[model samples]
Target: MGTVLITGMGRGIGRELARVLLRRGDRVIGTVRDERSISGEWSEFLASGQLRMLVLDVRDETAIRKAAAQVDEPIDVLVNNAGIIGPQRQSTLDMDFEGFLETLNINTLGPLRITHAFLPHLRRAKAGKIVTISSRMGSLSYAKADRIAYRASKAAVNKVMQGLAEDLRPEGIVAISVHPGWVRTDMGGTGADISVAESAAGLATLIDRVACEDSGGFFDWQGDRLPF
Candidate 1:
């Protein structure tokens, strides 16, 4: 079993992913925005030292660094899951500039910041992997205009992950962006196609088998390749 760090484990996909990993005997280091996000279900795991929780906003670089300092062990996987769906007024013509910026900060830049803060710990691992939870809506082939801010932010982050994969290739580190499917979550809404359990299970299996060749590529929850 390995240690996996997941951001935004308060609820939804991130929480589910943490649960799946922990149950499979992998140590989980989950991050939430605050103490209130902590769930009573995780009490046993936390007490057993199988789970570690870090409270920090991904946008705050200082907070991320401080949290990273507390973890001295190697992290096998870093899952960048914390993100926002963007403002209600996130259309191409009608956009809330401030809200758009916040979306970019959380969705696009947050993963990079967290990855940077935990680089040393990841480097200590045998084969560190960076998996950023991105959306298929960001695909360039799709000309969809809905939620422009969210789409733009995800697209930007995908590019960032690709670049990271290239730069870290020589070191044997793997980085890939993932489309977690239309999961039924707060962000995905109730009408979404798949349940959280289904999506999370697929994601966990996909993450388990990622190799160096998978780096710089984008894949869905089912481990199928997608066009970037």
Candidate 2:
């Protein structure tokens, strides 16, 4: 069984992904901003020795590095799932620049920081992978005006993952970004199209099939390639 590391596993898609992996016999390292944030299901996983819950805020690079050091096993996969919806006032006319910066910190740079911290562990594994959860809203081909901050951050992170894929290619580590669809969650809202379970299951399957050739690519939850 592979060891998978997932950020923002406190809820939603990340939590469901962790559940799917654990059920498949893969060990999971899940991160949460608060110790109290972990669900009852995850607590059971921890008790069963199938999961390790780490207290980490993806925005904190130092905490991420420390958490990486604590992981004794080689990480087969690293999933960057943590992100934000940006400021409430995200309109171009009256945007919250500080909140936009915070979004960049969590959405764009957070993955880079976590990946940098765990690269060595990943390199030691047989099939190392890096998967970043981006969004179709970020696609340059499907540009929209709303949620500018969030959209911009996702777009930027996509490019970062592309660069990471190129840099990690020789090491046999695959890096790809994925669009999880509009999942129902705290961020996605109840009116969203897909359920968290559906999106997470599809993403888990996609991540499992990520081969060396898939590096630097962006795909939907169903494994279909998407335009940059």
Candidate 3:
């Protein structure tokens, strides 16, 4: 089984993804803000040495680099799943500039920082894969007007990952953005169609099949290509 590193394993999709991966025999090196933040259910994997928890806030570049240095396992896949929805008050007419900036910093810049830090380890693997959890709301083709900051941030990161895929193509690293669908998570809300288990399972399957041929593409959790 391959080693997978995921950001924001404290809760939601990231946490479910970690569980699914671990249960499937993949060594999961997951990140959280701190030990207390992780779910108690993860304790079994921690004790079994299948899950290694790192204290990391993706927004902190210095901490990301340090965490990279500390990880001994060669990461086959790096999943950038940590993100935040901007304040509800943010809008086109009345904008929360500070929240918008924070959203960009964490949702966009955070993945870039983590990816750069882990590039060396990823390169060591025979075939590396980088999966950034983005959203369909980020699609420029759609003109829906709501949550401006969150949508803008995801859009920026999608472009960033596309560029990164190009840069890493020659090295045989597959980098792509994935939309995990609207799941029943804190961010997705209870009314969402899919459950966390479904999203995580589908995402893990999609990520497992990514190859150099799929680099720079945008895909949904169900393994369908998405319009950028």
Local accuracy by lDDT, each model = 0.96, 0.93, 0.93
RMSD of 1: 0.5
Question: What does candidate 3's lDDT look like per residue over 87-153, in tens digits?
Answer: 8767899898999999999999999999999999999998999999999999998788799999999
Candidate 3 vs. true structure, TM-score: 0.98
Q: Residue 118 error for model 3, in Å?
A: 0.6
| Residue 109 local lDDT, model 1 | 96
- Index of the highest-lDDT prediction: 1
Checking candidate 1 for backbone clashes, the offending pairs are none
Question: Among all windows of ten consecutive residues in candidate 2, which has the lowest summed lDDT?
Answer: 37-46
What is the per-residue lDDT of model 2 for residues 90-187, given as tens digits with 9 covering 90 to 100?
87788999999999999999999999999999988998999999999899999689999999999999999999999989999999999999999999
Error of 3 at 110 (Å): 0.5
lDDT by residue for model 1 (105-213), tens: 9999999999999989889999999999999999998889999999999999999999999999998999999999999999999999999999999999999999999
